[model samples]
Target: MTDTSSAGWGLRGTAGVSFAATLEFDAVEVKLGGRVVLDHFSLTLKPGEIVCLLGESGSGKSTALRVAAGIQPVHGGAVRINGTAVSAPGLNTPPDRRGIGLMFQDFALFPHLTVLQNVLFGLRRLGREAALGQARAALRRVGLGDREEDYPHMLSGGQQQRLALARSVAPRPGVLLLDEPFSSLDARLRETVREETLAVLRETHVTSLIVTHDPEEAMVLGDRVALLRHGRIAQIGTAAEIYRQPIDLSAARFFSPLSEIESVVTNGHAPTPLGLVATPGLADGTAVTIAIRPAGGARMAILGPGTPGRIVGKRDAIGIDICEVSVEGLDLPLGLRQPSDAGLSVGQDVFVTLNREHVLVFARD
Candidate 1:
């Protein structure tokens, strides 16, 4: 039910084609070399919604994308596009007919073909004149119209990426699958291209599933972020939702470094070096692990106002000092990240304080 009239890339999608699509992986499981790569992986992307799939290497992020594009077959479960079962046990759909566009980490542009010809490669279904018009329009949409006749080798890295995107969208597919599309760009160029890419995606309204490992990238590019673990979805939510309310310690640690404390819950609370963290549903005497983020989670306090500690080590990272404080009762030094302007030094005597929201208490494994 996407409105193709204002589709983002400026090319009307294929005639009678859906402008955007609903994609689902219904408990899909993928195996390779007799090893499970996607274990009951399930996710759903709504029409025109952009979602980021995030995880560490070997966590099945790219595998999920390949499954969506029909490049990788699932050993169990099913994949659906706009409610049609495109992939399932005993059924498989060819990638070409699925109306899904794929952009790989390398951009995958044809070195010999001119930018325009590269785009036209996917539009062969249209008449030559119509295909040319669509390719040129797609090039223009991605700011590469003037480079139509230029070969892929002639363009810069960013331009080549744009050309690949133009090629992917020229056919006006209903969904776009991008695998670490910006990971290869230099930091500055990556930022610029990310913004431009997001703009086009918003304008075209193609349902997009982007796979990346960087947490910030997930937050910046996705309406919601899905984190994969061991070939399954560990947690999925808005960046703020996942960051503020992680489902477990592993989910919390995925977003940032953490200082862990082990204790037992008593009176519905888990006591830590900082304070008692609420364990609302846990029984008394239950073992628990409390975690605190180093940055903006804990801080040096007045010498007499908080738990007494000595700054045992310190290092500067991007203007923030990661101070390691040794408390008398803890086995591990607590990490406190604060602005260097605070003038904390190693061996400095100070008390430590923490915010309740910055503390997370979970059942010990």
Candidate 2:
């Protein structure tokens, strides 16, 4: 396929046309302090595709970004942009020439330089007048055009982020990398800023890779999610695919708040207090792990007929009412979150049932 990002700009009224670009990580490997940070990591982003890279700390999320940005050296493999090998064995392309833009977690604005100057920094290849025009248009794209004359310290946290985004995109990079771009903002502001950022990215149609620890944020920003585990791509899929059908036990645990039950498969079923859950493809007598997500997936009732349980406690957790239920034959109280208007409270007698949608069965190790 042709490289769509060759145009380098968009014709948005007066702005340049933004064509998308592709990014490829071919078996990339990186080690820091003799510790392997990334191992045989391979992923690709199509032109204008937005992918969210999700991983825990020390899981090579940032290292992956640095590798693509040409700031971190790889021990093996290659990083490619627009079909060109930028980082490979004995080949390292300077970041400025990589046709990519990086928006850092700290916003990384020059404290002394005006906003327009900072945006202009990346457009140096163009003539002075053209650079000014591109910088102004970029600022306007991010809603920071009026603040071009203001210093970084003079702007709010959200505005600073917008300035940084403008600076990164002013050069009309084919690939845009954002490292925890909204982590510094408060929850309310982060949502608004994230919406704005997603809009700009879609408008420009830039291939974007966002690094975030937030699952919800990843789902909101990414067209696909690439989950990393111990320097490897554990799973790569759409939000629904990853959330609904995880690759394994660890993945299921990572995506949902689960209550674990260890059971042995018997006659193609695993018996539990809820009922006989089907265990297909597992031999009889095989040990299996059953994960149940109680929040919004387990139905609890006070009047209907079901497995009887007494509500031991209840609390409002993140806009949901999670109740502790003590069922017979169980050693611990099961945490079951109820729907809004259930009006459930502690010490109430209730019936509990597992929603098959929230249940996951995995063969034990």
Candidate 3:
């Protein structure tokens, strides 16, 4: 999983070295305006490990990060770094002394300061010469060594963001907090910047908590994803674990685009229009929701002497055709696998069949 590049200034030249650091959050909770923002939210990240708080807006993802960084006061609970209690009720430490770096979504570079100045801002307590030297080195690590004199506006969006990261980490913080770092970038540039940012972070061995709503982004960046639900963690695992074995239908859909099909579970199997799918350990007579991913290769069983379904309609998606198929009077929308100039034509009966093993079944609540 390591990438080697000739543009090397990081720990690339070293052998058997990792940026990994240990980070922990213990029963952290926060309240805003008399409402609980985070309740018993907890996660751990090993040194050089990137953990993402994955959830939608107002789900306490950012609040958790801010509290961990000591930027936001906690109403209850505690946060720790490397097992050292950093935040606890009635004991507040200033952000600068917490050894936690925060990179905001807006880059937050001082408008008047040049790129180098912004990076050197945190290092002021150190003598001027030493601070400048460290800032130069940090800028070099982010591939902006020569552009130190350029103002924040002079640099590209990605470069500006990298500057912000450099500023946050200039003091060599033990933990890094990123709040939707790539949300402001255009889609095409976001992934590239993310990759670069991750590389830089890995090089420095900074334990990072990335807050993002995009599941795919979390999958690509995090060693583990904490799916936050209503101020609590709904699921926590690697991308494959969360995607393949979600605890419920909500978690399943949150991690991936899945179509839910209602089925009656019987004898460790669920009966669907596609066929009887075996779901071992599922209680019999329980109504369950079967989650099917788009790339599961489940064929329509309505045609070709297979299962029965009526073609309801089809829509034109930029890269794919989405077909709506009704089975047993239930409308299930699925992305059709075919290429045509006109896309999927409306009203075409088709057979659909999926590997029962890939179907994720969760109790309907």
Say which candidate scores most in TM-score. 2
Instruction: Give lDDT: candidate 1, residue 303.
Output: 60
What TM-score should be assigned to candidate 2?
Answer: 0.92
What is the TM-score of candidate 1? 0.88
lDDT of 1 by residue, 81-163 (tens): 99999988778899999999989989988888998989999999999999988888788777777888889999888888888
In candidate 2, the residue pairs with backbone N, CA or C atoms under 3 Å apart (3 or more residues apart, or in different chains) clash, namely 9-16, 9-17, 9-18, 10-16, 10-17, 10-18, 11-16, 11-17
Model 2 has a clash total of: 8
For candidate 2, the per-residue lDDT at 7 reads 23
| Model 2: residue 300 alpha-carbon error in angstroms | 0.7
Q: What order do you get sorting by TM-score, best first?
A: 2, 1, 3
* 274-310 per-residue lDDT for model 2 (tens digits): 7778998999999998888766556888886678999
lDDT per model, in order? 0.86, 0.85, 0.76
Model 2: lDDT to the true structure: 0.85
* lDDT (C-alpha) at residue 298 in model 1: 77
lDDT of 2 at 70: 93
- Model 1: lDDT to the true structure: 0.86
